[model samples]
Target chain A: MKPKIAIVSASGCRACETTMLDIHYGVSALNRWAEIQFWPFVLGSSMADLERIDHLDVCFFSGAIATGSDRAMAEMLRKKCDRLVAVGACAAYGGMPGLKNLKKPATAEAADRGDLPEELALPEQENRVRALDGVDGIDRVDAVVPGCPAPVNLVWAAVSALVCGGEADARITYAAARLPEEMVRPILSGLGPPPGAVFAGEKAVCATCSRKKEEKRFKAVKRPYQAYESTGRCLLEQGLICQGIATREGCGGLCTGVGVPCRGCYGKPPATFDPGAKMVSAISSTFETEKPAEIQKIADDFVDMTGCFYRYTLPAQCMLMKG
Target chain B: MTDYEPKIIAFLCNWCSYVAADAAGVSRFQQAANVRVIRVFCSGMVDPSYVLKAFSSGADAVLVAGCHPGDCHYISGNMKALRRSFLLANLLKEMGVDEGRFRLEWIAASESPRYAEVINEMSESVRQLGPMH
Candidate 1:
C-alpha cells in the first residue's frame, strides 16, 4: 500500500515547493512509490479537500507562520498528517522575512480599529513570523529540512525515508537503474532524522569546505566587496565575514565552493545556541581590535549585524516587544 | 516610574567586579537593590547568548563588568570582554533593544565605590525607561 503524502506551503515564496518539482527522481517516480494526496499546485484540490483528508502519512510543510490564515492552515495540516516535515529554512527557522521582527510590530490600537468591512479586512498577519513548531497548536515537527529552497538530495533522502522502506528503494533502484549510493543514506531509513532532528549533516559548513585553514587572528572585518585576496584560502582568514564557521553543513558547500560566502539559510547548527549569538562570541575571541576607536570601526563594518547574523532566524530568536 | 524597579542582571567577573561588589557590601555603601549579580570566572566567558537570554527572560537591563585593561586575572580575558561588548552592543542596537538596556563597564577590585555607583546609575536609568516591553 502506498503512503498518502501531502505537500503544502504556509506563507512561503513557493520556491521550496517549486524546487520539489525537480527532486531528480521526478514526480512520476514519486507517484509510483507513494500517493501524493494534496500538493498545492496543478491539482484540483481546495482548502475543503485539505480539511476533508483523514490521515496523511507525511506532509512537507514549507514556509513560516506569517498570518492568521497561515497559522490556521499549519495547525490543520499538522492535525491531518501523521508526520509533519518542516521543509526549507522558513519552516525550520523562520527565513528571510523573519527579519521584520527587528522593527516594531503593528500597534494594538490598529488591531482595535473597526473601520474596514468584514471582507475588506486584511488577512491579519501575526506580529512576528514563526516556524511551524513555534505555532501554538503545533507542538513539534517530526523532521526539519533546512535550506533556502531546501537542497534536492536531502529532501529526496527525507522523502524516501518517510514514504518507503529499504525494500522499495531497492526495487526503485532496480527498476530505474540510476539510484546513486550517496543519495540513499543508510541512516535515514525511516522518518529520517529522529523526531525534531535536522535533515542535514551534524557538522558545520567549515568542516566541509576544502579551503586551507590557519589559526584565526581576526584584525578587522572586510565587507564582501573589500575582500581582495581570493587565493582559495579560508574566506574568514582573508578578513571577509564568511558565516560558514557557524552555519550547518550540507548543500555540498555550494556557496563556499565557488568563493561566495554562506548566508546561513540552513538555519542554526546542531548542539548550539542561536547561530547569531554564537557568531558574535566567536568573533570576540578571534578579533584583536584594541582601542575603542578600533572596536567601533569593526562594528561599523558590520553595517547590519542583525541581517548578517540573524537573517534567517530573527523570528525564532526575537524577543517579543509587542503584544 | 519612581515606584517601578528595573530588573538589572549584572554579570560581574569573579576576580575583579565580583570582589569589588563584595567590598562594596562590606563597606556599607548605599547601593541600588535592583541589580542581581551572577558571578562569572571571567567577563569574556559570558557568551553573547547569556546576555540575550537575560534580556528575553526578565532583565530590563544587563551589565557585564570585568577587570580594567591589563588587570585581568586571566591575562587578556578583559580584552576579549571589551571586544565582545562592542559586538554585543552593535547587535542589540540592530535588534532594536533599547540603547540603555545593555552596558559594559570595567571596575578594578580596589574600586568598591565605583561598583556601587555603576549599579545605582544603571538602576536609575532603567527606572526612567520603565519595565522591559
Candidate 2:
C-alpha cells in the first residue's frame, strides 16, 4: 500500500513546506508512491478535515511550539501519525522563534490593546517557544530533518524514503527515474538515516566544507556587512565568524559551498548542547593573540553576543530564565 | 549568624588556582564555606557550556580561576581561558544574568590568601543578590 503523507505547519513562516515542494522533479515520484493526506499550507483543508483523519503514515511537522494551540496541534498529529518527523530547524530544535526566550516572554494580550473586535482575540502564547520534540508530551521525534527551510535535498531524501517503503534504513532500489543526469545531485539521492537520529549528520559542517583552510589567525572578527571580497579561503580564516565549526554537517555545506558564510540554520552538532558555547571556544582558540589585554579587546568586538551565538537555540539554553 | 549561604561554583586550574585552593585548605585559611570547587587541568579546558551549566544548576555565582598571564603551565592555556571568560561574561550579562555572578581571576600557586579572599568576596556578593533562581 502507498504510504500516507501529511505536511503540517504550526507557527512557522511556511518556508519548510514550500522548500519541500521545491523538489520539483521528485513531485511525480512522490505522488506515485505516497498519498498526501493533508497539506494545509497551500491546499484547502480545515482543522476539521485534519481531525477527521484516523491515521497518517508519515507527518512532516514544522514550526516552533509558541502557543497553547500549537502544542495541541502537535499532540493531535502525534496520536495519528506513525512517524512524526520534525522537518525544519524550528521543529527539530528551537529555531529563530526560540530567541524570544532570551527576553521576558511577550503576551498575546498586547494584540487586544488596540481595541479590535471581541471575536478577533488571539490565542494565549506560551511563556517560552520550544522545538516540537522539546515539549513534555511530544518529547520524541522519530527523526529530524534539520535546516532553516530544510534544504530541498534533505526533503527529497525523506520523501523518497517513505516511497521506497519499510524503515528509515531501507535501501532504495530505484531513485527518481524521471530526473536526468545533471538534475540528480548527491544530496537528493540518498535515504534518510535510521530513526532516533537527532541530526542529519555526525560531523560538523567544517569537516565537509570544501573551502581552502590554513592556520587560522585573525586579530579581529568582522560582521557580514563589514566583509570584503572573498578570498575563496575559509570564512573563519577571514575573521567573518562562520558557524560551520559548530553547526551539524548536512545539506552538503550548501551555503559555504557557494560564497555565503554559514548562519547555523542547522542547529549545533549532535555532541553539543549549545552552539554558541562551541562558537565561543572556536573563536577564542583560532584568534591570533598572545597578549591578555588584546584578548579583552577582541571579546569587546561582539556587539550582541546572544544574538550572534544563541540566535536560534535560546529556548533550550542552559538557563531558561534569568533569575 | 545567618542560615542562608550562596552556593558558588568555582573552576580552578590544576597548575595554579587548584594548587592555591588546596594550599588554602591545608593552611587553615578562613575562606567562605559556600564554595564547591571543580579542579580542571587548565582554566582553558573549562568550556563556556560549563559556565552556563553552573548558573543554571542553582549556583548563585560561578568563578573561573587560573594562572596569572604568561604563567600558564601549558603556556597560553590561561590566555584562551581569559578570552573565553570575557566573551562568556558578556553572553551571561546579555541573558539578564548579573555581571557580578560570573567572574574570571588569576590566582597563582603561591597566592593561597588571594584564593581565600576571592571566594569569600564572591560568596558575600552572591549572598546579597540571593539565590540564582
Candidate 3:
C-alpha cells in the first residue's frame, strides 16, 4: 500500500507550497511510493475532507500558528497523522511574523487602530498569532524541517525517506542535506571529524562562511542603508551587524555569500538559548570602546536593536512574552 | 509596600567586584540584604542568558559588577563586559523591562564602599518598580 501524506498550510504566505512545487521532477519520484491524500493548495481539499481522513502516514505542516483556527488545524493534524513534520521556519520557530513581537503591545495596538481605515478594519482573528510551539500540546511534533521556505531538496529528501519506511533516519538525512559541502566533504573523504551536528553544522554560521575574519575593531556600527564597499572581508568585521556568529549555518551562507549581511533566518546555533541575546553579546564584544558614554554612543548606532536581533525568531525568544 | 523586598542577582568579577564585596563585608559596610552574589572570573564571562535567567527565575533586578575600564586583570575582559552590558540594557528596554532593572557597574577592589552603594541603589530602585512579571 502507498504511504498517505497530507500537506497543511497554516498562516504562511504559501512559500512552503512554492517550495513543494520547486521540487519539480522529484514530485514524480515521490509519487511512486506515496499518495498525497490532501493538499488544499493544489488538490482543492476542504477542511471537511481533512476531517474525513482517518489516518495519514505523514503530515507536512507549514507556517506559524497565527490564529485560533491555525492552532485547531495543528492539533487536528497531530491527532490524525502518525508522523508530523514542521516544514518551514514559520512552523519551526515563528519566522518573519515573529518580528512583530519586538514592537510594544501598545504601539502595535495603536498602529492597528490608527493605520487601517474604517472599511478596512483588520479581522479579530488576525490578532491571535502565535508560534507553532506556543500552542499548548504542540511539543509532540515528530520532526522539524527548518528554513525560511525550507530548501526544496531537503524537504524532498525528508519526505522520500519517510515514505520509504526509513522514518528513523529521515531527520538525520535532512540535516546532512542542509550541511555545507565544505563541511561534509571532509567527512566524506575521511579527513575531518565525524558528523554529529544537528540540522546545521555544530558551530556557528561563521564557521562555514567564506569571508576572511581579520581582527575586528569598530568605533561605530553601520546600518545596511549606510554605504560601504564590500572588500570581500567579513561583513561583521566591517561594522555591519552580520549575525553569522550567532546564527545556525543551514542556508549555506546564502545571504552572506552575496554580500548581504545575515539576519539569522535559521535561528540560534546549537547550545544557544536565545539568538537575539547571543547576537547582542557577540556584537558588544566587538565594540572598540571601554568608556561607558562612548560605548553607549556606539550602541545608539543600532536603529532597531530588537528587530535586528530577533527578526526571525522573536516569538520563541526568552524575553518576548508568549502570545 | 515598605515590607516588599526586591530580589537582586549580582554577578561579580572575582578580581574586582567580588573582592570589593568581601571587603565591604569585612569593613562592616551595610548594603541591601536583597542581593544574592555569584562570583565569576571576569564580568565578560557573564553571558546574557545568565541575566535573563535571573529575571525569569524571579530576580527583581540583575547587577553585573566588574573591574573598572583599563583595569581588567585579563587586559580587556571588563571592556568587553562594558560593551555587552550596553547592548543588554537596550535589549531589556526593548523587551519592556524597566531601565533600572539591569545594571552594569565598574567597581575596583579598593572601592568597597562603591559596591555597598550600588547594591543599596539597585535595591531601592527595584523596590520602587515592584516585582518583575
Interface RMSD of each: 2.0, 1.7, 1.4
Interface RMSD of 2: 1.7
Put down candidate 1 lDDT per residue, A87-160, tens digits, no spaces.
99898888886776665445423556744455434777787778888888998799888889887777776676
What is the lDDT, from 0 to 100, of the residue B60 in candidate 3? 89
lDDT per prediction? 0.79, 0.76, 0.77
Model 3 compared with the native: what TM-score? 0.87
Model 3 error, position A180 (Å): 9.3
Q: Between candidates 2 and 3, which one is better according to lDDT?
A: 3
Instruction: Give me the runs in candidate 1 sitting further than 4 Å from their true place.
Output: A104-120, A167-192, A318-323
Docking level for model 3: medium
- DockQ, per model, reads 0.59, 0.66, 0.72
Clashing pairs in 2: none
> Which window of ten consecutive residues has the lowest lDDT sum in model 1 chain B?
B88-97
What's the distance in Å from true for residue A71, model 1?
1.6
For chain B alone, what TM-score does every candidate structure achieve against the true structure?
Answer: 0.97, 0.96, 0.97
Higher-scoring candidate on DockQ, 1 or 2: 2
